[model samples]
Target: MTAPSRPPSDVSAGVGLAGLVGLFAWLAVCRAWPAIAFHLGLATPLEPLSGPTAALAAVLFSGLAMALWSVLVDKVHRRPSTGIDWTRPRPLDEVIDISITKIAGLWATWAVIGFAYCVARWYWQGQYVFAMEVLGAAMLPLFVLSVPYVLWLDRVLVDPRDGAWHFGAMLIGREACDPEQVRIHWRAWAVKGFFCAFMISILPPGWAELTRLDWAEVFASPFAMTHWLTELLFLVDVQIAMVGYLLTCKPLDAQIRSANPHLAGWVAALVCYPPFILMGPGSPLDYHYGTADWSVWLAGWPAPLLWLWGGVLVALTAVYAWATVAFGLRFSNLTWRGTLTNGPYRWTRHPAYLSKNLFWWLSTLPFLVTTHNVNDAVRNTAIMALVSAVYFWRAKTEEAHLLAEDPKYREYHAWMEQAPTLTRALGRLLGAARRRPALQPAE
Candidate 1:
C-alpha cells in the first residue's frame, strides 16, 4: 500500500515553537530581574516580577514574539486568507460610515458584556474579582482606542461590512443586514466575552506558583519535580491561550473567521467552562471524592515506580500544553480562526483532549481510592468515565462545526481516516461494521 498523504497546516510548527521560546525567555527574565538589578548597582534592587502585572506582561511578550515571527518570517499579512488588501487604500470619506457602524456594534457589545458582569454574582467573587478589576480599568482606554482602530482598518478591508457591521445596521435599521451575520457576530463576541474573563482570572495563580517555586526543593523529590513541571506547562498553555483569545486582530491574521453556529457546539463548549462547568468541585460531575492522587497512592511504592509514574504524568501534561502551543496565536474553543495540522496534531485529531483524559485517569486513579468502600471506587470510576464521555461529545461537536466551516479541516479529517493511528484503526473498525450484512430474520 502507498503511504498516506500529508495535508498542509495553516500554522507552521516553527511559529508556535518560536512563541514558546519567547514566553519562556520572558519568564526567565522575570525570574532573574532582581539579580540583574543588584548587579547593575541600582539604588534599590528590583522586586521579583511575580504579580498579576507580570503575568499580563508575559502575555504581551509571547504575543509580540509570535506576531513578529508571523510577519517577519511567515509574512502572514500578505496572505489572501487574511481578507485584507493593504496595497489599496480607500479614502477616509469612503469608509467612514462603515467604520462608524462597526464601532457602534463593537462598543454596544462591550457595554452589554459589562452590564452582564455587573449583574453576575460570580464576577465579584473569588478569582473572577481580579478579572473584573482588570477589565474595568481597561474599559476607558479600550473605548477611546477602538474608534481610531476601527476607522483605520475599514479602509483596506476587502469587505468592510463584516458581521459586526451587519449587527450595527440591524440595530439602526438604516442599512440592510443579514440576520445570519448578526447571529455570527453575537456568537463570536459571546465566546470572547465569556472565555477572555475566565482565561485572565486563571492567569495569575499558576504564574505566581511557578515564579515562587523553589527549584532546589522541586528537584530533590520525583513528586515535586513532576508536579511543578506539570504546573509550569499549564502556565505556558494558559499564557499562550490567553494571548489567542485577546489578540483576534485581522492585521495579525488571527481573527475569528466564524464562531460555531450550531447550538450543540455552544452547549458542549459552555459546559466545559466556568459558571456552567459540570465537573467543578461539588458539582454534578464531581469525581474527586474518596480518592487519592497518584503521589499519595504511590507513596509506599518503590522509588523506580514512583519516578516512572511521575515521568508519565509529566509527559501527558506536556502533550496537553504542546497542543495549545501548536495553535500559536490562533487558539480558541468553538471558533474557526485557522486549521492546525502540525505539532502533536500530526498524530491525533484531538491531542489535548486525548492527553487530558489520560492524565485525569492516571493522576486521579479513581478506581484505587483511599477509602476501602467498593461503592466509592465504582462511583468515582463511573463519574470519571462520564466526564471523558462529555469531552468526547465536545470533540464531536467541534469536528462538526469545523467540517462545516472549513474545507481544509474536512480534507484533514479524511486523511486521518487512512493514517496509521488509533483514530484510523477505530474508523476502519466502524466502517467495516457498517458494511457487514445484517443477519436475516428467519426466512
Candidate 2:
C-alpha cells in the first residue's frame, strides 16, 4: 500500500512546489507581496496597498504569466515522431504550412513583447494609467481583429507567408469535421478564442466598473464628448468600408496554407459568437448586473428578435461572404484567400473585414458614454489604426507571395494601376467641382 501511494504523493508534491514558485515570483515582481502574505495568513511588517497601484501590479503580473504560458503550452507534453522535430512544425497541409508557422511565431513573439513592455514598466514604477489598463483589457479583441485583416490583405496583394497573423480559421474549419481530434486540440482553439472573447467582453465592463469608481468628473466634459464623437465617426467609416469584403469573400479551407495561413484566426474571431454582444456595454459581467435599457433588450420576445437580427443581418453577411470565397466565385481565378474578385471583391480588396469592423463600432456606440468614453476612444482608435496599417501590409505581402503562383500578377498589377483610373477620375472630377469658383450668382 505504501509503494502504490508513493507515485501519487510525489506527483502532488511536485505540482504544489511549482505553484508555490510561480506565486512567489509573481508577488516579488509587483512589489506587493503583502497580498500573498495576507492570503497565506502570514503576519507581515509592510502595509497592504490598494486602489490603482495594487490593481495595476496584480494585472501586470497576471498578464505576463499568461503570455509565457501561451508561448510554452502549445508544444508541451508532445514529442516529435522519428526524425520529425516538434520544435519545428511538420507541414500538415501544403498551402497552410507557411501561414501557420508565421502565425504561431508571430503570436509567441507579440505576446512576449507586448506583455514584457508592461511587466518591465510595472517592476520599475509599480503602477499604470487607467487608460493603459483599459487598453490592456482590449488586447484580445484587437488581436482577433488583426488576423482576417492580415489574411484578406495578403490574398489581395501577394507576399511571402511570414506567419505574423494567427488567423487560424481554415485549420479549424478542416478539423471541425473530426470532432474527436478537434476536442483534443480544442484547448489550443480555446486559448485563442479566450483572448478574442476577452477583447470583446472585458472592455465594456472594465470601463463601466472603472466609472463607478469615481473618475466621472475627470473624464466628463464637452471636449471629451467631441473627441468621442469624432472617433466614433471614424470607426463607422472604417466598418462601412469593410462591408464590401464581406459580401464577396470566399472559403478558408480551399486556399493554400503557404499564402493565406491565418484563416483560423479569422474563424476564431467569428466562432466566438457575434461581436454584437460587445456592442452595448457588453453582455453584463453578472447576469443580474446589467443596465436597465440593456435588460429590456435582453428579456422576452425582444431578446430573441435582437439575436436573430444580429445573426442574420450582421453575422450572416460576413459568414456568407466567407462561404462565397470558399465555394469558388465566378470570373475570378483567385484561390481560397486569393485575390478579391467576387461580389464586393471587384470593387475593393477588403469588404468583409471592413464591414465587420463597422458593425462592431455601430453596436458599441450606446455603451461609450461617460468614463467608458475614454476607453472607447482609445480602443477603437487603436483597432482602426491597426486595421489601416494591416490593409497596406497585406497588400504588399500578397503581391510578393503571388509572384510564383501567377507571374501574370505583374500584368494584374499593371492593370490595377490603370484600373483605379475611373475611381481616381471620379474623385478628381468631384474635387474640381468643389473647387470651381462658387457660381458668381451665389455671391
Candidate 3:
C-alpha cells in the first residue's frame, strides 16, 4: 500500500516567518544606522539611507538574510526538490564543456535582454531610469561571475542539461536540443527581465518617502499614518520580491521549476504590469477617472470613522504584503519556484489579489465620484469591476499553471478545496454553476 501523504506545502511556516524576521531586523538596523553613528561620536554622522543605492542595499541585506535562514535553519539545500547531489560532484573535465555551453546561453540571454532594454523607450523614462542605471552597473560583474558559478553548479546538478543548456545547444548546432526546453528558457528569462527592472525602478521612491518621513507629522493624522504605513508594507513586498528574482540558485532550493507555458497566463500577468498595464491613468481599464480617494470622500467625517476606515485599508495592504512575504525567497510571477501554503496563503489561494482588489475598491470608492455626475460614478464603478475581473482572470491562469506543474501544488489545491476558505467557497460556487444544466428551451 502507498504511504500516507505528507503535508501539501513544500515551504513551512517557520521558513518564511524566519525570513520575515530577518528582513525586518535588517530594515530596523538600516533605519537606525544614522542615530547609531551620531551616538558613537563620529566626525560626520552617517546620513539616513534614503538613496536608490541604499534601497538596493536593502534588497541585498534581505536576500542575504533569507538565504542564511533557508540554508542554515531549514537546510533546503539537502532537499531532493533542488535537483542537486552534493555528495557526488562530477570531475571538472566531465562537466566543463556543459558548463561552457550553459555560460554561453546565459551570456547571450543577458545580451538580448540588454538590447531589448536599449530599444524600449520606456526603460529610459520615468521610474525605469534607476533600474537601467543599476542593471548597467552590474552587467560586467554578472558576466564575469557566471563562468565560475556555472562551472561549479554544473558539477553537482542532477542533470546539467537544463533549459539553458538546451538553448545553448540549439544556438551552436551541437547536440540535439528539445525545442520545448528552449521555449521554457526564454519564458523564464523574459519574466526575470521584465519584472526585475520594474521592481528596481520603484524601490527608490518608497525608500525615500520612508527614510525621510517625520514621525511627528506622520502620527498627527489618521490618513497620513495609514498612507505611510501602507507605503512601508509595499516597500517590504518589493524588496523581498526583488530578492526572489535575483536569487534563483539551486542550493537555496529557490530555482524556478518552470515558467507558465500558456500564452493566456503571460497575457494575464503582463497586462497588470508596466508597458502593458491597462489599469493605469487614461488606459483602457482606468478606473480612477473621476473618483476621489477615501480620505477625500470621507473628509470632515467623525474622527472615529476616519480611524476605522484608515485602519481597515492599512490592514488590507498588510495582508497583500504578507502574501509576498510568505513566499520568502521563492516569489515571482508566472513561475513555480515552489509551493506556499502557509501565512496568508492558508486563508486563500490568492490573498494578494483578493486583498489588493479590495484595497483598491475601498480606498478609491469608485462609486462616489468627485465630478458629481451619475454617469461618471457609473463609469468609474464599472471600470473598477473590470479591473477586478482582470485579476480574477490572472488568478485562474496562475492556478492552471501551478496545478499542471507540481504535484505539491495539486495536493495543496485539493487541501484548500476541502478547507473552509474563500477560495474553496468560490470554487464550489463555480463548480455548481458549471454543473447546473442550462435552462431548457420551450418544448
Which is the leading candidate under TM-score?
1
What C-alpha lDDT does candidate 1 achieve relative to the native structure? 0.89
lDDT of 3 by residue, 59-118 (tens): 877788788888888899999989999999999999999988888889999999999999
Q: What clash count goes with each model?
A: 0, 41, 0
Q: Assess candidate 1 and give its TM-score to the true structure.
A: 0.94
Each prediction's whole-model lDDT (CA): 0.89, 0.36, 0.88
Model 3 stretches astray by more than 4 angstroms: 1-6, 40-46, 425-443
Model 3: how far residue 85 lies from native, Å: 0.6
Error of 2 at 319 (Å): 7.4
Residue-level lDDT of model 2, residues 1-443, one tens digit each, is: 22211111101122212322343354343344456677778776444333344433333333333223322442212322111223443233433544554455445555754665466443233223343554467669757875655443343223323223323322434322333332323333333332322322222322222223333542464333323333323322222212212222112111222322244333423333333232223342111112233223333555456545444334424532342322221111112223333344333444544554455444443333334456554655554445434444544444555554453444444454455433355667999999898556744
- Which pairs clash inside model 3? none
Residue runs of model 2 more than 4 Å from their true location after superposition: 1-316, 319-340, 370-379, 403-405, 413-443
lDDT of 1 at 128: 93
> In candidate 3, how many Å is residue 408 off?
1.6
Q: Write down the TM-score of every candidate.
A: 0.94, 0.28, 0.93
Off by over 4 Å in 1: 1-4, 41-46, 425-443
Backbone clashes, candidate 1: 0
Give candidates' CA RMSD values in order: 3.8, 21.6, 4.1
Model 1: per-residue Cα lDDT over 193-281, one tens digit each: 99999999999998888877777978888899998989999998999999899989888899999999889888887888889999899
